[model samples]
Target: MPNATATPPAFRYQGWSLFSLLAALVLLMTVMILIINPDLTEGVRSAIRATARSSFVLFLLAFTASAFAVLVPSPLSKSLVRERRFIGLAFAFSHLIHAVLIYWYGQLNTEFWPGRTALGNVPGTVGYVFVLLLALTSFKSTTRLIGATAWKRLHTTGMWVLAAIFAYSNFKRIPMSDWYVLPFGLICAATAIRLMGKLAQANKRQSLQRVA
Candidate 1:
């Protein structure tokens, strides 16, 4: 039996605690958006874009945290590893806000939406599908339902697919402004970092086995 005197795991690690905080953060941002803007439609669009940026950044952070912890010798990276699930859920929450605003956009002016053809929906739809799958399987029980090996395959494929979507989305908009370069560069850098970290961790593990 577990020790009765031991403290429970931090809320970030145990069940829905971290998700609740993420929901609150998204909600507060939403409320502030409404309060601050005189033009609600513009505000909603701005909020959508803001949430888009937040979700992308969160996704990058979540995707890299574990390998980063393995590669780096730092308390911060290790903390990020511990909070990986929380960070992922936070990314989902941010995207949930993004989805809400998108729906609102469609309701207010659906013509602003892309044509119903798969062309316009290609990457966006793909990203959402993976996010939903990832979020659902994020639970230990749900992950077990698919078996660990299959779950690993799905997540690995999904993460790469999502990363490509993010990179493509930003790169395609280069005509808008030079400012887009920064985010595109950041995503590319993060991807490279994750790959390098994984290789380093793999080499370390092999070395340990050899030593043992």
Candidate 2:
């Protein structure tokens, strides 16, 4: 008998896969940015000192944009969600950079990256831990081993962790007037709304069944 299960085309190593293309573009962009700017190092660089903070701020903005881009409801939204695993991995790498920048800032200012106290490290550490877990479980092997139900549960938890870290990071980086924050915050709200709508629809269907 022939094998019953068919592999998803998305999982196959297609030539020029979206994940590969995005990864290449990001790598090229980073190289270009460094070459154009020079002195991209974290220390002993005047340009670094001038732009480091805003770079992180802008990173947060871009991160939020990428997340919203995936969530935006449209024709491509389903494909975006289908490819979320890859997109999420990319987001995790960006978050990792943001994490390093925070640690580096702590080293530089002696009071900024993490505050002056031991407690200051808590939030940054929490953020790092979240990103680390995200990175580790993001592997396709790990997802396959965990099975879909388990993986979905894990992803739900990851989402909450992600939301928490986003809030913590933004709160720590407050006093900036970035209009993007409103939309970023809305992404979380939208998730909640979507879930509630799903539940309502399910409940409505059940009530009709009972009446029939």
Candidate 3:
């Protein structure tokens, strides 16, 4: 029997707990959608084939979610800092999905996976590179072997690279890109707050030393 005063394991793993609940909800919705309209999913896929809009929406969602996984106040951030392998993997998955959706759109009308260039093709290449770097750092062995200091440097640089990828992608599409401002804004605001906090702490320590 568990100790009466002991907090449950779920409480301690807050990030996983939240992810589990959200995953359950997504599964339930999938089941409901499957049952209610069996062909709806395929029908939508068919529609997305000719229209790049669908992929754009999914790419945006993926970009935003992955960005939030970094910026949002969550146990996931703590897990990442602690080098939790699974959480890093989850972030990689989200970023990969975003990359795939963008790639889907890019390839929907052309043959530019590893070759060929077009007006809209550059951002896709840059975006994939960002995702690849992120995935590389996400591996447990890679992070552990590199150590936290190096990992931080790599991840911080990756964030800027990732941001540039999304920003460039959004701007390349002009009016369609305007929607990206939301996630980009969220990331920027979170970064500013974090920097401000650090500055405040430094000032506090300096004041304390002066008083002493």
Using all chains and alpha carbons, the TM-scores for the candidates as numbered come to: 0.88, 0.59, 0.51
lDDT of 3: 0.50
Clashing pairs in 1: none
Please write out the lDDT profile of model 2 over residues 59-130, one tens digit for every residue.
333234324433453434434445666666655655544455445555656655343577766765775676
Candidate 1 stretches with Cα past 4 Å from truth are 1-15, 114-117
Better model by TM-score: candidate 2 vs candidate 3? 2
lDDT of 3 at 149: 95
Better of 1 and 2 by lDDT: 1
- Candidate 2 stretches with Cα past 4 Å from truth are 1-16, 36-74, 99-116, 178-180, 192-212
Q: Judged by lDDT against the true structure, how good is candidate 1?
A: 0.82
Q: Which candidate is the best by TM-score?
A: 1
Residue runs of model 3 more than 4 Å from their true location after superposition: 1-88, 99-119, 171-174, 177-181, 201-212
What TM-score does model 3 achieve against the real structure? 0.51
